[model samples]
Target chain A: MHKDRLVAVAFTLWAVLVTGAFLQANGAYLFGKLLERLGR
Target chain B: MLAFAVTAALILALAGLGRPLAWRLGTCRNGQHLTEAELWALAPLLGALPLAVLVQVVGAWRYDPLSMAVTLAVALLPALAFLRLRPFVPVLPWWPWGWMLAVLVGLMAVSALAPPLDHDSIRYHLTLPRRDLELGRIGLWFGWSIYEFFPPLTALLTRLAYALGGAAAAQMLNVFWVVMAALWAGLLARRLGLGPQGAMAAALLFVSQRVVLNLGAAVTTDIPLAAFIGAFAAVAVAGTEGARRALLLGLLLGAAMATKYQGIVAAVAMMTPLAVLALLRRRGLPALILAGSVALLVLSPILLRNFWITGNPVFPTAHPLFGADNLDIFAPFTQAMAARSVVPGGLAALPWTMFILQDAFDGLQFGFPILLLGLPFAFFRHQGGRALCLVGIVIYTLVWWGAMPHLLRFLQPIFVPLAALAAAGLVEVAVVGRRIGWFRPVFAASVGVAIGIQALFAGSSALYRLPVALGLADIRSALEVPAFQYYGLITPCLWLQDNLRPGERYVAVINDPSVYCPQAPTLHPLGAGEAARFYSRGGLPALSAAQVAEMLRGGNVRYVLVANNPGTDDETYAFAKHRFDAVLLPILRQQKPLVDSASGKIYDALAVLAALESGIGAAEPASGR
Candidate 1:
């Protein structure tokens, strides 16, 4: 159980990091509409 | 050639971009080198995706903004990841990915050489793609038009194929899904308590069969539907907390739902397991959150689309809880048609023996008879497994009851779990073989024979082709490759681009316009039985038989290709015969034949366009003038 939780935490952190990077780089293209609205 | 070149470049570029990310993911998961088995398991799945560059590139010919974006994401991400992962792993298994790839590529080649055999796809799937290529935009869809409402995921791939691979790009797309399905099956097997080898065996068994042959190599929705549903199920199982996984599950579920209405059932079915876990497990709040969030998230986009178009979130099926009727008297009444309905005599009307035999135990032309073998054992073994199997059976029973005289496509979701259960049974057999020394040889021989029988059946059906053996000899023939041809949604669209003329308008009278014209000149989907919208005001619905005849008289409709063949009343055939002669005779006579096969026929571009534009009345004068 402890190992599984640790694995889950690691997976989550990795998912967030990768997703964040993708959002930052390609964010302009992928989420342009939402971002523009947010800026407003 | 031009389209194929461009598509290849785009795929390579996107793959390049994704490699870093894919590598990052792999590194994060296990780090450094991969085991022989992991390499083997991973190889086939990755190689199977990002399939023929021609298919994806061909879609650019039409350039649907929405579909293009999604394709770029799916294609590039995986391609890049594979490239990155390969370099990181030093030693890999010879038998794992290597053999799997050999068989898969072989199947693809063989199926390509075989004739297109999807009954409905040829009737309309290829028909639409052919039209899309010929026509720049699709106008309207009607008459056996249920196909139009399907999600754009597969069509986008087909459009890419049409852009890159010319007409046969759908074949490449099929190879892609065959890989996706295999990967998902492997994942599902792991979840069901199978080793890597066992999972591979199950994946190969499911992918390299006759039933898979029909959908995997052709442009059909069944395999994609199955893939999405199974993926959703896997995700649902993976989620530890109810809330966390539920949210993810919802998104996946929604994506599946958007793919097809049948996915709604699959989404619900998948949720049932999570719900059970929530009830049984201590972390009920998290489970509930996960399940509910996922369901809502996944269902929202389609629900919103439905609500926006049909004035009800469910659309075309049921009225919204707080909404008024979305129809008026003038529109065609489409309310009573059910997605699943009961016909009198049901299975009795079908060839009961053949149906039972095929459903219970499919051989070469189909999958192994897992349901019969697994259900009995499931009852005696794991309670949870038995419960899951029962739920699946109930769902299938309801679906079958409602969808009497249904096609094989309708049974996909049920099959996913059935395959898992069957894999469990096979694992048991392997264990039993290990226990008894003498039985080991017999078991191995039996497995060999079973595989041989399946291969022979699959080969005889011309569903797919097997690869050349690694060793050249009569005995080594067992190592033949497996080729696939089904492209899920892309098949019809690819056919359209290859056969049809560029810059023509082919009106598809269906909600899912991709069914007829993947890249039509003027695509006007009738969302949520919005038939009246087309009929009202300046919509294409005004282009009725009389209107079409008038357009033909004006030399507007040069060619008319209707895919509502064989299945419908003789009225449609009679309608085409009378109208084409009375209205489009001159144009038909003058126009070049676009496509003529067992599927349908296409005609000259100018004639059909002219007929559509000028109305049927100006047949001689409009052209001459």
Candidate 2:
């Protein structure tokens, strides 16, 4: 992979880890509420 | 409506008062003035200094409306004379403005218009100010709360707002600090040689954060401390030279320290690098000294007051060093907080834990990820202010981790520098995107989505409370809802306000939420360290029913408020059950409570005492009702 592409891939993985962790820990409840409200 | 209006007026007044001082200090040695963004950012903070000082001075005399109005008039006369109006212009792009407006409106609807419901706000932030106003002086509320010994700057400011309008206005004042912090973050970004776009990104990122949105518009020291810390960073990083810069830096440092104890950690973190850098240059030594001196001068009032009362410059912290008595009464509470550290893997696991297990650390999650994502990128490029911000963040995080990493809220100051560095990182990512076509859209989409998620959360939270803010629903009725019923003392306080006669006092036991009962005089017997002095002996449970009754009678307490359910599993309850409940429960059974709800039960002190004397209901078990 090109250096820039490698950097991009690593950054994408880090973002996923962070976002996933957030959702699992705290954001899931709020997000669930948001989704439920939208469903209603 | 009146609260919003009063808050707006106070913001303008503070800006007016601070403008002259900010201008004088904002001028660079080369004769160029700081950008308007920088000047305006510094204005409210600079303006708040004199007002805070005035509050302390007037507090010695009395905190009545007459005294407050007279002092304010005297101070504002000069401020009004120096006030200069400038045409309002929007410097940032429309997108940043839209996000800021949405956040601001949401905060106003959710927090500013509603009665204070946050634990710390009711416990001390608004409570202490209300207590001082009621007492007609700012004397030592020694047994009332340990927070009385904390820095009084924000409390002083809150008192001013509370005096002017009410608790709602005091709550609304925090909105000003939020905006000021955002603006200061933008100023710091600009100082870092990040272009206007980067500045907007920094500011928007800051305001849209979960922590900022959650704590915004509540009467808390966190936002004000962040604002002052941001202002300090912005000024410290400016290319200004000599005494003027020193003076401005000192004032800001002092303000930060005066806002909260964590301010001391922030100052040490940021200033250590600046001092070392200055020493390396040799010529900057005198300027550093001048700044240090000014900071001490600004912090002296709080120091002197604490030393005078408790023989400790920073009371409740360094108790053994200063021989500050009675603080040991709170050791169990403090120890419980220490034991509650949820960062499982310690220092090595901090970064992951801070970002991932935020609930364990007792904070909302969105802010840390962007910081984690962007800060590393900030170091890749040779940005002007990047080195300073990076060092500050590193030192601050390390110190915070060592001291109290469990409390994510204490890390509020680091957000100022972290936001700047993260914005730089985002800018760097954009630079990379220029070479790769697909990367550009991805970058935009990511940033947009992150900010959108934050705004959505903030807007929804605000929507829940929109009826109260819009005056469509009564605040009391709203507070009675199950969500707020646990900590919201409004319902019980309303009952007390109606029932308690003049010259009557209520003793609150294991209930710290009596702050809402400003109309009635209330005392925290267990909270005030009196339990340690009178009830406990030989580290064993020695409390008796007669002793508790006598303490109440001696204090002229007519009512007794006991926590039936403290909402959370509190150490105080655990400790009290062993030592206090056995004695008090028997007495409480004798009297029909004046008010009983989920929050607590309030009993007639006279009836309880009569029952105690008559030996009625003596066989009631130690188990609490």
Candidate 3:
């Protein structure tokens, strides 16, 4: 149970960081559209 | 409070209006069953709607817009980053424990030496922060501020290393909290049995720009409370065998409750979910044990302390419970509830809309846009996760809407669980990647890249923005600015130990009172006078003018600081001009200018006091205590 839990946690950390990295590389355009609304 | 009203109205409107649009556009869908990673990543933005509404309402009432704006901006920026990342990717690479340990250590190190920019730290948060930095134990009668009388669990642990070793030894306390927060986030993820991807996503959300930048480094009670809340939630999720965990969880929950009053809300929210589950499972004994232990462990001390202090278990808060006369806590609530007949000005409406826009995209300052995504997901049946997340959101939203004192730090406890669910929802959506071929992958990749970029920029901007805004260009320039000096003088607080003689006290009679120059006398209680009181706790009473006049007929205040541009209604100026002319400042000679602004000058008060002490005045006054 403990090992399984650890595995889950380990995977989650990786997924989050990878997701963050992906967002860093490619998600800026969509996010930028959101930011443009701020000019109002 | 008109600001609060329009804000609350707008929030209800936005949530009502936007969720459907977001869903219809498929913006609500992120992936699949939330990984532990995603849960941790997205927990902070739970209270976005309520907070944005509250800020707008507060803004509408004509409170200082800049600080309000700054607070909202700071809090929402992280939410935006997360929201941007939600669609395309939801998780990261899972490192081994060894790698995680090293990374945690590095993050912790960065947290400590980073210049303490959190204003509340020196004022209240770090009165305990600094005290914990020095003495590991929560000392008694810490006269710094009344706010320091919070749950000392976090303070005790943070200061323990410093106290056992030496002063400045526990500079790594911030690092400890950062690591602990990450560790706890991991624990929470594991407890939820999230997949590798889910857990990583959760972890990222937890360490997202919002959590790390805002709560990690700042020595405040918020992170600790959030930590305990997560711990309690984790234990409560451990199932039938976890009945044993109840008492322990109760203790931590109690400690969480003690950290801040909002901890009470979290405790209730967490426990309620557990109780309902136990009931549904027909585990009567475990349910009883859990409920009883929690009440006994948590409520007993709180009730005892409350009764001891204010004759009620909840001595401080009187509204909706037995009414208490403490206006400080309840006044904002009452004022916000009271409807003003006059319409708020047009300028007021401007910020109202701006905060709404900011909060929608930015998560009200921490930048967790994923929160905007998560609320729709709350309608789905993940039972445990959904229930917990909903409870947290409701509590946070209610608190924000009902009583907005306009302090973001107050809302810290609400963020943890909210972030958890938002991350979960994001991951849940990301899991849909298998269905939509090109669309899924494209969306997932774009989101991940977007959030990552936004986080980098947001973090950099947030890190640099305050210092730049405060005009902290250089050491000399910083010191020359009173505001900058206030932030820069953490080390100077330690300097008083070596610089001053044991018996001699320095009194600065500055017309303008500042946080940096706390040894000065003025109407603003938190100024220099409060600092002197903190240093001289239980030792010497620095004589206010009325008190000084009764003793020595007008001598012995030893020093006076006369600052330029000490604005109108400066109590010191009035005293100097009218009442104190005869007794004080007999030899008022100018010294080197302290601040660069037109309103800056340092005066030598010892010489003046010395002359006064030597029979320069006729009034033979009695000595005062």
Candidate 4:
């Protein structure tokens, strides 16, 4: 609930969410998944 | 060697001179003192860029040793006097001994000795400056290559190197900037309140990133830009508000801008946070204006030069504004690689794709490991430090994703701050664990282990290449790696340099340009668009190949370095893009090459493209029919 904690949450979500999605498409998952993600 | 020594002295002297300039600005105060390392890291760029521009303004791109020696000899006066006057104690915690173990110093020495083999180095990084040295003045000789117009801060240093010892020496200057960047990284960590060990870890992590490791020996605008931007960020983060602090900020930002256009974006990113803090204190505009003015002081010369030469202020981009027809080469080349940038579903998928899904060798090659794993630490606590670094990373990352995600090295500037923040994160954890009794040893060990791993990664790269970089190994074989691995062949270029007469001019009919500068007068034949339009389309305008060769002869080309480099070298094959070069392939196949490499052939331009009479005849007109 503190302002600092809120700031931390916002930043962490941005880095991890965007970074996590990119990780999967970049060859993290199976080739099929990568292809599927790429197609979408 | 004398020129190099003089240049070193000149850099130190400039640092000495900059101290006063910084003092006079009186911008930073109340906990804004610069570390010894930070000051040293930033000093050379501060000194060299302005002096290099001065030399250029006088139309002296000849880079003659005497000119440099005399100029620097005068510069040494104040520098020595200043050094003698200011004997200060170092405040660093002694934890970065790992630099020696990594043979970091040795890597710099060796790579400097090894020939420059990076793609950009050969193509235009070296070639543009090399041509100017030949002509004895600074001017845009490579009209087809748009890289000529980008800021020349790094290239100015390259000019000095070329003037001193030729291409290899020019490129070797990167070794200096590499060390500067690492030192800045570690010191920046220290400023963020990380311990000496954490600072060292930060520096080690910075060096461990494969691109950073590789780029030191290879000349590109990236490494120097990293050093300058890192230096700028260091000053911005550690120093408090004052006239002097603002001036130092301006100087570093200007130096960064002088190195690459990214400096402008980075300057804005760096200033926004500080300006806000000042505004919160109810006095922001003066600081902002001072910082902006100092940055412009360093940056304006390059812009003036561009405006004079290109008519458009930011050349090729604002072609519509300038109303210059078709001065747009860089934009198209960038657009060609656009698909690789998009995260399929776009921002929604960027995180996963940039890190794990993308090819290991492609953009963001070191993706988000050290950077992302430590993200929570960056954001969690130390609100002041966390916010400073986070704002930069988020802004640059979003911008990078939106516009130019496919190109990886551009991420270097952003990564420096991120890496520092990551180091800060670990340091925080290490500090907290000590107070927690039972968890103390485990946390300490983890921190040590992580730092050790990064140091090992950094060390092994330097040690592996130590011999080659130092010229202990067969440098000739090492230099043979084409700047563009898929396209160029090195042996034929070596053969041309070894066998061709001195002072001869070479027309390289392929993608790589590294070899041409060291050997002879050089010309890269076509721009990126010209290549794509001609080769990817599968044919040249019915103009015969020999006619183009005739054009070369008139331009005084003695030999042509010809390689296939088309569908053979790159993967993005929506189209073929080596038309002018491919046109040379048939001509090469028909000849007994003067010599050959694994992937290329070298032929006497006079003999291969023409015997006496025949050349590519102009296409017959339909009207003739």
Candidate 5:
């Protein structure tokens, strides 16, 4: 309920959003390449 | 392995040469010596500019291996006097060291195993230097591309690397720049009064960025430019008010300018505030003047060369001021770039779009979201140099947004200062959050997750090239692998190198990767646009087969290398389809190519032209009807 806690919560949410977006964008391609290489 | 050894030797030599100079300049105004970390970080940064200038001087005379060796020996001989200065031993915690080791190994593997094959490197970075080595002098090859007029500092440095240990060596040399940039980031964080952990975090954040990982090992100017810009920021933020500091700042700025044109923007961003502050205080004016003059001295070679060749000190830019006609060849490509106007969602949306839709800018996903997330938290701490770092980032980004192309890589230099701020913010937030229950754990977990994802991406990218790096497979074999086709026109270029006789000239069309072709290929800058504009004159469609053949003969071009698929949506294909297909393709189709594959076709230009001339003569009487 404190302002500092609220700030921390907001930052945490932003970090999660960013991390999710990055993974969503690049995770599939990276994993696919790894799989392809492993198969090879 | 030889390439790696040569690159390492070069880096140590540079560090040795720079140590005393950095020591002199980095000592605080109050007579305090630099920390070991700061000195080691500053040494290579100080050393590289002078060596780059030395290479330019030697290159201007002649860029032979013997001359380069002699120049290097002369430079190293003086540095030997500073042997008493001990070797740098980084005193970092285990985790940071682990991350650094991983990144370094991955980067070195990629750089040491591969020849320079990235698009920009092949196009000009390595190609220009290769041409200089061939010609035995660093004269302007105006016929190649407009990029020839750009600052040749990094190219000159690459030339030394190329002369010593070949293309792989030059690539390995670029990895040094990446390391230097990361080191400067850490040093900047330290100057901002961050603890050792925060400094290491800043360095790791910078090195782990996808953009850095992607281009870190490539023989390109961006990484080196970033290093110089970062070094300048670190020095500027030290609050050392003396002539030596000013000189150091000037040299770094000059080196950055010589590395890339965007350095001009960086210089303006850094100096504008300092100049204004100094003017208000009525002190430091003389120091500023000394710094400005020294920077100009460092940059004068490129400016003079451009002025001599194009009548524009900064050619390709300020064309309107000079009214120079040399850039006419670049008009179509330049116009196409202008039409793209790459800033999507306008200036207001740049912050959102730059991070979210990074692909829209240049197809390279650059910068981490953690950087954006951590940026605001730096303001909460009210740290010593936070205000300065924030101002530099803001000014640099604003200028880049307005004046420069919206490519993510151009904004790379700003990442050094931004990473410092971000690291400071994260560290500060964690320190503050310890008072609140549950905040520290949640924050730590989120930060860890973000960094872990980035590391995974970086590691995966590096892992793909590990086989060639570990010598399990030959580099040639790796080049032929379909999965590694983005290594540019290696197969076709090697085929040309093997086939083309000495003294025979080839013309590379559509995609020019002539750095790989040793037989002196004439490059049509970005496909057939410049070729259509120059050789065909009015248009390829307007010119007859005889005229085209005559033009080819006039240029003494014997072979034609054409990429069949140059990506239709890009400007290369658009220009080729509009102008090249009209006249050149039909003539080229008449001849059986010397080499043909999925990559492209290589034709005997003389044969193609000969057939065209004879066919035109044969059809003249029939056309009389």
Candidate 6:
């Protein structure tokens, strides 16, 4: 049970890094578009 | 509205017939059974798609609604007879199902409702068949359709659709394939022993990807090929050994290969597993041979056709074997293709580059963040089935990273397994939630946020042309960014259709000659490819405008529509802009405009006819000759 908990915690942490990077990377494009829309 | 409705009915009927047929062909063995839902999922490629491509091929020399309809009926009737023999199963439950269905129908209705505006579809998928329909045959040898040398799987079906109703009918084929891909996603997740929710999540991830949503409505073979990859994965997970599994896997692989060249990537990915399995069971040699034989047989006709015409099975690739006359033309192209801008930081940065950086070359990227989020969970434990789905994903990803890392569409086939694994991750999150109290809401919040974000991006973009689908508009004026650019270009084609002289043909120097000039037989001529191959072989002399036009005229290529700029099609060759300038500069100046506008110059081919009549027709074409 403890090991499963540990694995889950590791997974959550890993996911956080990936999700953060993805959102940040994806946001560059999204932000550009939002700005374009705003400017329009 | 009526056009959309009628075309929808026609494609649904065709796809309906295909489902039963696919079930009959794919599961015909001892102890082999599949539910209706499963059959529906797999049938598009296994049963119906082959039939569709075959109908177009056999009826190539003489294709029309009457002939094609008869051919389709011949294929569908037999499959319809097998419908009652298959076992039935229901679709997995809601959340995913409801979301998937909504997204699928939304995409279908949008794609079907709008005219086919995908630049590639306009250029070839719809264009090749439209040209063949004009020529009254499959007519690959003569017509320098550039696309004809490649596989005809996507074109043939779209051609059938074009013949039946119009562009809308052909667009529905893409829609049906997208839906099939979604179904396969569910089945692949289920095969991985994910629960119904997990299955739904898998499928949802597939449809949710912004690229899939954008591409779902657009006619392309990437998604269809991806669907086949999923089908192949599901078959691999079936725990079968020996000839049956090999045959099924081969069939799926062949279907993938037929759809796009990327199928070779998929073929290798799936073949590795089969090879390992065969070795373990001591059936390695025979199994490999069977699989190889089937794929070769499927591809043989195309290869043979290519060999027959160009003396090369793949065409333009084996310049040395076939005589290295075209080195200059092909060398740079080969180098340019091989020299893809390495995603900076190589494989380590691939995750961020693929998933995060949305604006890679040509605004193409498909790795949804949720997929990344959920992927780790798929590896938490051994998935269901004797076959390792993870191995297939790893193989496919490695191959993608090795060969073509940056190009998303080429790597799209891996999406099937990737989406399923992501779903498994989500399910794992739920498992973790069950263990840890506070983690439960975190998982739920993540799910809610992930789904919300994906839906917002994918759904909004997909619905851009929904008004056209809803019968509220006439022509596509409100298309999203890239597609909207195509609206003005179709005007010249429409104008040409109305104004052109009978038996007067055209060659589109513009990017997509097919879309612009659908009324008459128009050819893009792929001047860059022609020039490259022509100039590559050193002996080929600088052919004059008269000489070039005369050479093209041998295949009944007459008038050429030289675009002011490259029209809306994806860039096939880097030096495409130089084709007309280098080869036919004088024709642009000397030939009188049949209908010269801002779109491009439509030069009369009668000059070539005149040159021939005057006996100035120079040396024949050395390339596609």
**B1-625 per-residue lDDT for model 4 (tens digits):** 5334543654565565555554444333466676555554555656765566655754453456666556556555657656466565665545454554256545655655555556566656776676566566667632444566788877776776666666556656776667667777777777777777887777766766657766676677777777777777777777546777777777778887877887777767777777777788887568668878988977887777777765655653444456424334444556656644445555776654454545532643463355554546654555575587678666766777665536667777766776788777756555555455544664544445444534544554454456665567664455445434434356666676676675567776565454453433564454434543332224235434655665576667778776646434332221222435646666666777777665576788878656422533333344266
For model 4 the local lDDT of residue B342 reads 47
Flag regions of model 3 displaced more than 4 Å. Answer: A1-40, B1-108, B128-138, B142-144, B164-171, B191-193, B240-243, B276-364, B374-383, B404-408, B461-499, B508-546, B549-557, B560-602, B607-625
- Which numbered prediction scores highest in DockQ against the true structure? 6
In terms of TM-score, how similar is model 2 to the real structure?
0.89
lDDT of 6 by residue, B165-209 (tens): 677767766777777787788888887878777777778788777
Question: Candidate 1: where are CA atoms >4 Å away?
Answer: A1-40, B1-101, B109-117, B126-144, B242-244, B310-355, B359-371, B378-397, B403-405, B437-449, B461-530, B533-549, B559-625
Best by TM-score: 2
The TM-scores, one per candidate, come to 0.61, 0.89, 0.59, 0.80, 0.88, 0.83
Write the residue-wise lDDT of candidate 3 on A1-40 in tens digits.
3433433344345446544543443356436744753542
RMSD of each: 15.5, 4.2, 16.6, 6.6, 4.1, 5.7
Worst-scoring 10-residue span by lDDT in model 4 chain B: B568-577
Error (Å) of candidate 6 at residue B58 is: 4.0
Candidate 5 residue pairs that clash: B510-B527
lDDT of 6 at B245: 56
lDDT at residue B486 of model 5 (Cα atoms): 34
Error of 4 at B102 (Å): 6.2
Best by lDDT: 2
lDDT of each: 0.46, 0.71, 0.43, 0.60, 0.71, 0.64
- CAPRI band for model 1: incorrect
